[model samples]
Target: MTDTGPRVRRIDAPRQDRQDTETYPTVARAVTAARRLVHRHPDRCRLREVGRSRAGRPLFLLSVDDGERTVLAVGGPHPNEPVGLAAAVGLAERVLELPPRPGVGWHVLLCLDPDGAALNEGWLHGPLTPARHYEHFFRPAFHEQPELLPAPDGPLAPMPESRVLTGLIDELRPVLQCSLHGVDFGGAFVQLTRPLPGLAAGFARSVARGGIPLDVDSYDAVGWDSPAPGTYVMPAPGTRWRALPDRPELSTWSYAGRYGGVTAVLEVPMWAIDAVGDARPHPDVRAAVGAAARTLHERIAELTGLLPQVPPHAGVAYGPLLRAIEFNLEVSPLLVEEWLADWSPAPLSVSRVTTARIVAQRLPLRIASMLLRLLADSGGPAADAARARARGIIAASLEGLHRLGIRWVPIGTQVGHQTRAALAAADLLLARR
Candidate 1:
């Protein structure tokens, strides 16, 4: 059969579309692109106000329709994972221009958390390294996170943005949904609320086409099981989340039960480890996991511990930022113990090797670099000395990352992979119907 579905191709956004010299558009830049499409192409696009974020930035839902099966694309659920900000904007431009599929609709939430997104805007442009990105990364506490649910009918933190998304989920009840998320380091991978058979390979293709590999190895898979290469089923949150008393959480996709639909989480990467998918034999898998976990916890502890001793740091609000940093750092110490309590030796995967070598080496620097940035911004002798020490920490971490054979990947390619995947998913979904 000669296929005539709308084909997805890698798009090159005009330089002006970036809103800045940085290849990755900031949340503000994406918002401009989304709004421009709506205003300029009124017949094809409509913009609706979703709600206001906790920070009072207005949230919006852009509905693009020629109409096939409608899909709700979510971006910027977390500030630290900013790739979605770019992906959402790029997808909007393409969808608006593409011949609309009859009965297919795309309702895109340009960004769910502008405030959080702003926190990471520092590294959005350049020095696009793991350390640089994580330095400005900001993820809210679990209870406060919008992805957990957005909002309820009544009082429950009342995340206006999530509330807007919740309303959309209830109103649109999409056939398929995808949340664009990225990681600081590792290969590319996908997370699904439920298995989307044949989707994983599509995700791999998208990565490969974009010149990246499926992040076959990932720390994100610690508690989850992979039913397919590059596809991960996030374990239902229960005890693991509860263990962090202060950080109660719920995954946005968990609401998949409330609203019947397929949800795909496309996790791209800031840097790619080519050999992440390797299945070669190696040392004890359990040991690597344990060691990585310990090293992570120790680094977390060291940074968190240093914050208090630095004379409480001054200039620009550090309280919440520090707590946010501490929250991420605090959560890891218990992860290995939790996983290993029932750990049995399985053939160590290549991921295990990368985890011990690369991820373990670089992950710490992510948080550590952020801590150092805070210290650098702190105006004082003690702060200066701390910043100097932090420079050393970052230097050592980079050395370790290089020793582990990690390399940086282009952000533009990452965005292209993501945008094409969404378009492809939309094409396949509309075709099957």
Candidate 2:
């Protein structure tokens, strides 16, 4: 490829900020921060409305011009992973503060799925405990998730938010597409569509500098097969997506791949700092995982049978809290079934151990949070009855996390891990020129 962009000095990662990621804000707050950046620096950037969400929230694209190859940094590809919004805000601000850099333009879609994000806003401002976070947790079913929606080959029509994102990708044809995704447990890891020399090492160092470990036993660890300490390459398309025929939609990265672009997936955890970049092995991996799965199935069955009594809201939009809970209850057990199908006896890695703890504990609590939200958000005497019943479900998940002794990770350090990965990957792409 020939170069067409202007020349500039090497891009430096922004200095760590103590307060930047301290507050986990709602979608509203993220939108506000994005607007603030544009309004404050009218001479530098423009906040454009790319499209409206399915829920009617106006999706935004904050752009600052420079260079030939645009950089599309998508935040909140999945609603539960809100850390990206923080990283996006920090990145845009840093770009605004410094003079324009060459070979890239900054275009950030700050909140990709506002409806799903709003569903998760309950735990953003936190006491920052595992119990509290788990109790407030909410994630859409695979079919309903923002990125997975508008399934690549399904008969269903594309969601409004999916249309907006796809439109942007087609419009920009970026050089680097960083879809910020983080998990609730385990340690940090990197996923890239194509291997970038030295980028993985830089990523591990970046995360380590923030004092986080590389989760050795990732849920996907069994599949991706780590190339370096914490870095993983997603399996080739031919080798994966073998199941779930209904889920055929192209991911933001997959779609961008057609343009010969690179994707950087940064997965960090909300807690479990002790697992940081850990390499040590623990005993009885398979036994613990089965025990955890069995425990989760038992708890989910109880909830599955109870939620129908609570009554269904007519539309998915009407009762976000109740619907989220109901959907999770149905899907939770199915996940354990998949895990069980793939089980094998092996040395327990931190990622695997952490994964079991989360599945057994936090997964139930995720539903409990939904149940509690149904009561807190709005329910009659029925809400009270549900809350009373929810105590058992809520306790189920907490027991596992507490047993494993997972600690709460601060928002700033989590953001630091994600932001650094993006910078490192960006620099890697630049160096190729």
Candidate 3:
């Protein structure tokens, strides 16, 4: 029921120069620019309309091929994450400058949520300040400050743009998929599919080459705090928490994983991009960031070629990795809160300890469910049974904290929510048979 055909008008041979820095005029303007770039490079680029947003905006996908392996990149699933949009647009332009290399191909789904994007267009036109922009569009925070915005009621509806992207993923089936996103106040990082030693090294090199200092701490472990250390907050009781049963199904990554390919989510801090002006700017930052993006693209291209060599059935160990991530999201809060409670003259402004305790208490059941899912997936039937036996202990610990009113969302929560929905959908898929 999604429209996966090109809807916007195409432009032919639009001028391109690094100096021709022009702020986007409007949503219309950005779409026009995207269409034009696709039109100009027809051999390498083809525009496809993927889907429509809830508000009826068309989602456009731009495909570029060098006659080899296909790589897919997408920007803006979350409306507020604009750095990816800018980077994707910039990358699209950059691709126009390079002739297709033999045996390599690329496709980009540009701004998968144009209607959501339009909502924040005012920020792009006015003061492009990061804090102000964040204050305006960050949706998760809306719960804390309900006056900020109203929650949408219904299924996890994809804006028309997102639906288009879903259709593209289902159709094109590219070997590698990257979703570009940016955090307001955080160090630069990449969210990868299981650690590939060679790929990880290349990613690190790309980050260093981009001149953005690597938060070595990020790679040290997985936790809600692991990827972006400070952004997490405690959740309230009855708050929903979920986990990825097998792998994340949001984009092509899960699909690619099924086929033994690499998929990644490249999260760049707004600070990494020179223009956002929230964090301190790095020297030669623009060049570094641009080079980093290009380098990552190149490395991904290499990985796609290498994936065929890796054994498809040789399941990689993601348990330790995901468990580390889960603890930070679900359990770390308890540890942190206990640590803070003992602090002399307790510090203000949501101490890490307090936040952790809140998450643990408020979402114990959810966390327990996540661990069970992970156990089942990892073939730890005994561990899963042991967890079931220990559920009472977990509940007691969580309930004690609940009496104190602490709460938080789990890391990789999206996977849980989507998985539930997917399971329900799968049941429906089976019933129809």
Candidate 4:
């Protein structure tokens, strides 16, 4: 693959500031900032209490309405990916500065999962290194996630947060909706609800300008059709290739489809790994997948085996860890089967191979961290023994991951890239109109 590194983009209205942001803000601080933004610009911005999180934290929507058509941006859809928290606020501030586009309005749902985000505050203010990230990591199980849950009519009760989003979708019927997300380590990539000509290239270009590598070989990207490098068409719900089914709840994009608007799931990396974008071929693709699958399976087994030993604790604090472990156990096998079934003689991209290895290395450590928390929550001889074992596992996982030499991307750079992509997407939608 021809490697033309990140290019500079010259623009006027939406530009990245020189502020070098080092650490992510905690959920409370982020919410306060959003409120302050509205308070400072009450004329252009309106902050409203849309709903409450399960934990009863009031969720607010900051609407900057100087235009007609609506563009909805949901931040912190996943508790672990807090890049969006900053991006949502930044986007609002940037848009307010520009003369409003006559055809477009911006509504940002700042910090969708505030309760879950609070759980990840340990590493939110960073020394954002790989070891710190894994040690402080937390992700809710799919069932607990608002975006992944089904509509309210199923066997499960809909998350209060999901209800807020769906209600907004129905009310605003936005022309474009962007879900902000970030990966722990990889290049930037995006998934769209439908084909939007040149939108993918626009996304790639924005991140590239930030000097963030393009994750051309994301395993999730592989499951969908790409119209451009680093951009994939989100597979329809119930896609057989998807390791986990949406089941009771439809995916956010699918649910948003009813309003005839487009959805974009934009993902940037917390840590930049150039190997994740290298398009060179791996000599033996199947062998690489097999090795990753075997390692991941072993780790899953080890973690799951310890699950029963730790007694169930009250409160939802450790619920995310348990949910995440369950999620991995359910999805890992299906993911491996799909990758192997689709195997071909043609070599796989080096980025794909690298990502496979990185995920295999990191996931176990992530689970171990969660397990440590779960173990710590329990009080017993088994729990004490499990805690010791979990620590040893985490130490080994961290040691192996550190050897990979992942480089950290400044929080400011990540926010800039996400902000640029979102603004560009809004522009494309207005242009199409």
Number of clashing pairs per prediction, in order:
10, 9, 20, 3
Highest-lDDT candidate = 4
* Best candidate (score: TM-score): 4
- Candidate scoring better on lDDT of 1 and 2: 2
Please identify model 2 stretches exceeding 4 Å from their true place: 1-14, 18-21, 238-249, 314-327, 375-386
Residues 1-433, candidate 3: write the lDDT tens digits: 1112222111111222231342433446646777888677666777767666655777667766654355567766556666556555655665566556455566676676565566456667666543234323422221111111222352444334444555665665655566666543323455554432223333344343344433332311223222332112112222333221111333344445554445556654443322221223234433433332333233233322322232223224323223332343433333333333332233322222222233333233333333333334333455445455435434554444445432221212211221121112112211221
CA lDDT of every candidate: 0.68, 0.69, 0.41, 0.76
Model 2 pairs in collision: 135-369, 152-248, 152-249, 213-276, 213-277, 214-276, 214-277, 217-351, 361-397
Candidate 2 TM-score, C-alpha based:
0.87
Candidate 1: the clashing residue pairs are: 67-102, 67-103, 67-104, 68-103, 68-104, 69-104, 150-162, 150-163, 187-215, 188-215
Better of 2 and 4 by TM-score: 4
lDDT of candidate 2 over 1-433, digit per residue (tens)? 1122333222234466434546776777777888888788887788888999877888889897656787888888778787878877767876786676655687888988888887677777766666666556677755566665555466988778878877887888877888888877767887777776666666666666776767765664446657787777766654552222222225666777777777877787777646434466756667766887788888887776657545444234346566666666766776677557655365656556666657677667777666665455445676567677777777756766666656666778877667666766665565566
* Candidate 1 local lDDT, 208-249, one digit each (tens): 766676766565666567887788776665535323443112
lDDT of 4 by residue, 1-433 (tens): 1212222222223465532667676767767887787788887788888999998998889899756678999998988888888888877877787776665679999888988888888886667666676667788877788887655577887789988998999988888899999988778998888987656666766776777889887876666787778888876555564455554217666677787888888898887778787888887888887777777777777777787865655325466677787787677666566556664333789888878777777777888887776666577787788888888778877675566657778888888877777776766666653
**Per-prediction TM-score:** 0.84, 0.87, 0.49, 0.90
